[model samples]
Target: MTTFASSLKKEIARVARKELKDELGALRKASASYRTEIAALKRQVRELQVALRQTSRRADKALHTVAPDAPAESPKRGRRAVFSAERFKAQRERLGLTQKDMAAYLGTSTLSVWKWETGQVTPRARFLPAILGLRTTGKREVLQQLARGAGGATD
Candidate 1:
């Protein structure tokens, strides 16, 4: 009887060891699956963060590309007078442009513009077409004509 009881106890112990090993193997497999899921979630989070950063940068660039508001300077009142030296001076004053700015637009020196305005010298006959072009069609047309070598006098 003692022998049979001892054998029975040994069998029960062996069965319990096998069951524990199987349960441990199942737990390890579940842990590995959870680890893979965590890695995938981390990758997704990183991709989302990168996309968000790109979107924010584009929005910031668009905001910067918009033009700023003009300052509080008032517009000049009354009709523009005729195109003369005095009128040109008044126009320059009203427009708040310097002689250098006008010269730059005319492709000449400020001194030349000053001489024309002061009546010490007249603009060349060729320059009249340019001036008329500037007056009628605007500066862009004058510049285009100058570039195309058709800016000077017809004669």
Candidate 2:
């Protein structure tokens, strides 16, 4: 009876060891595969870093070679809008744009448009083109343009 009990215990221990070895073998294979992937990613990162450095150097060289006063550059126009006072007032009323709304569209402060409407000031030359562009649009179109925020009601 003692021999039988000892032999049973030995068998159980052997089976457990075999199961643990198989599980550990699978884990070791997975770990090696992950290590290989990580190494490849590291190599790719090095290549990209080298490419970025080369690109930045080339851009710097190109910038240096460019003429300091190239025609590629243009003088920045002043912020000026030139619209008739009566026309501005009439259009704002027609398009249903309040002083605040007009400022929003014209990219000016509400006080500016208010003063412009009251004949105390005028729209800047820069804002003239945009306001003129708005001339072609109707009230509904203007509403849609203002609604160009995010996913709008019309959207």
Q: Evaluated with lDDT, which candidate comes out highest? A: 2
Give the per-residue lDDT digits (tens) of candidate 2, residues 1-155.
99999999999999999999999999999999999999999999999999999999876545433343433221235422334566668888998878888776667778988887776655555665666676677888777766763211110
TM-score (all chains, Cα) for each model: 0.38, 0.42
Model 1 collision count: 0
Off by over 4 Å in 1: 1-10, 67-155
lDDT of 1 by residue, 1-155 (tens): 99999999999999999999999999999999999999999999999999999999876544322223422221134422223455445545554557876666566778987976775555665555444344344545545655565633444
Cα lDDT for residue 32, candidate 2 = 100
TM-score attained by model 1: 0.38
Off by over 4 Å in 2: 1-82, 150-155
